[model samples]
Target: MVRRWKRVMAFLIAIIFCINCVMNIGVKGTYAENSNKDSNTEEVHTSAEEKEDTTEIEKETTSKAEKNKSDGDLSVDKNEKTTNKTEDDESKTKAVNNTILDWDTYKSKTTLVTVDDTNKRIYVKTGEALTLLSNCSAENYKDYIISLDSSVTGGAIEIPFTYDGYEFKGLGTKECPFEGNFNIANIKIQSTLFAGLL
Candidate 1:
């Protein structure tokens, strides 16, 4: 029975190998055929009239959206400044707390939001990493610890102004929630949470 089982397993392996070889050959042939066609093909061109029509349609859509904003169909700040943006505008121009915004402006700050597994550039306040680093810290010291790793040079405690609303991972205590929507550039809590702001 053992010999029969071995023979069957070997037969299955051989069958799988043959199938894989045939599939590889077929795929290679298909790829070669497509490449040959692409090399010989000429670029398609849109007529001048067609281009003009497309432009006009796009312009019309844009104008309609503008008209809606003017008519108050879209949310617009009544106190919005014409030029020379205020400091508040610069920092608060993003999703706040739990409020969501679809604008690319928020996503543009690649460091703030968790995007594509590129780890957040979170840092501790110079000397806070001594107690906790990897996992969450004590409930009481949750607000104190942000990160243990000190990637910054010169012991610079000031987080950048561009890092508005940046949330720190493995921060906050059991008593206090993790710091979210925090302006690391302008840290207020000094000794209580951050040691210095690295």
Candidate 2:
């Protein structure tokens, strides 16, 4: 009877030890799985944050690039306008040079007229005189009319003509050749003879 009791006690002790070992192994495995899961979650969060940061940086770079392009376009437009203005000035100068009229060849009331190139005026004898057409009676004079102030010797005269975009104006003698100032638009011509006459 005593031997049987000892055997039964020993068997119960062995069974309890095996149960404790199995429980400890299960707990350790669960803890290791939880640790691995936490590490993976942290990695995923870090990756998501990096992606967001990269997206923001890309957006900023694109915005700056677009602004620079618009500035460049404006610069190009300004340069083009300047070039066009320069070309217009050149064309106006050429037109004035090509339209010089010789007072000797011009058919006036009398041919007794003398031109002073240095003084930019015309002088006629006391007995004879010259004349300029003061009316818009020709086909080429359709844009404007001429008005001469006979009271003043060197007064402003409203002449008719336009070259490109310049209005022709002159101040000269109504009974003699051009004896005062002539201008194309706002540019004054320093010559005794009329320019762009029809």
Candidate 3:
């Protein structure tokens, strides 16, 4: 009976030992799996942070590029405006230079004669005499006489005058009657003849 009881106790001890071993193994496996899961979560969090950082960096780069492009466009626009204004000013200066009249050549061919307070006469050589008046009034003796000989031929003439804030150009031919009196008012006259013994 004593030996049988000893064998039974020994078997129970062995069975308890096996069960404790199995329980320890299960606990270790559970701990290892939890550790691996934690490591994977840390890796995922780290990757997400890196992705966010890259996205921010890309956005900043794009913003900087856009700002630089806007600045470049503004500079180009300013340069174009400056160049256009410079060209416009140069063209206006050229136009003003072109419009300046040369008076030296005109003075050699013309003579001015003052008649009275109201009448002034321009006498060319046997061609046409241009008359100038100070006011818009016509009187009998206020007329201008241009004397020409019978041998003078006929040609075209231009008479320039200013009256009432306007400039006037009178076209005449020397074939018109010359032994007559002419009247002009409010005018400064310049006459040129193309022909006729003048």
Candidate 4:
């Protein structure tokens, strides 16, 4: 019975090899026929209209390049003015309780909402608004703590900014609920629980 099984396996292998050889020959013939046809085909000639179109495209591209160059010069002037304004703002800023405060403008008597990078905290002064940096989302600072400073009992923190289409309603905490909508609730507490489970 073992000898019979070995003979059958050898026969199947031989048949598969013969089938592959036949398929290869047929594919080679098809490719050779296609190449011969391609060689005998006529060359394409562009019309006068096509040549004019190509020139127009080139002209449009050159004009766009010139416009971009002019825009770059305007951007350089804008950058200079921006740098001067930033230097002025820095000179006017004052540090209080290890947090940088931008006293340029504040709502009512409230202070500016500033980020404490060292302690990974964001301080939101009551009645003042907090607009996060560009390309930043609420989930980006999930680990950072929020410190609210309110002189009045009913004073609320307003977040009226959006980042990359994500609205900044607020990240509500149990102690200090948000005045408007919120995307997350007590992210720190949730993260702590998840870590404990792990």
lDDT of each: 0.45, 0.48, 0.48, 0.48
lDDT of 4 by residue, 142-172 (tens): 5556566433234334444432222333343
lDDT of 3 by residue, 1-198 (tens): 999999999999999999989989989999999999999999999999999999999999999999999999999999999999989977775554334223332224344322332443323332222322221122322334533323434654334443222222122223331222443322233643221111
- Candidate 3 vs candidate 4: the TM-score winner is 3
**lDDT for 121 (candidate 2):** 43
TM-score of candidate 1 against the unseen true structure: 0.22
In model 4, the Cα lDDT at residue 17 comes to 92
RMSD values, in order shown? 32.7, 13.9, 16.6, 25.2
Clashes by residue pair, model 4 = none
Q: Report the lDDT tens digits of candidate 2 across residue range 1-198.
A: 999999999999888989888888888888889888888888889889989999899899899888888988888898898889888887876664345334444324234334444544444421112223222112222232222223335433322344333333332323333333322222223333343333
Model 4 lDDT-worst window of ten? 189-198
TM-score, each model? 0.22, 0.37, 0.37, 0.28
As a whole number from 0 to 100, the lDDT of residue 124 in candidate 3 is 36
Please identify model 4 stretches exceeding 4 Å from their true place.
1-46, 94-151, 154-198
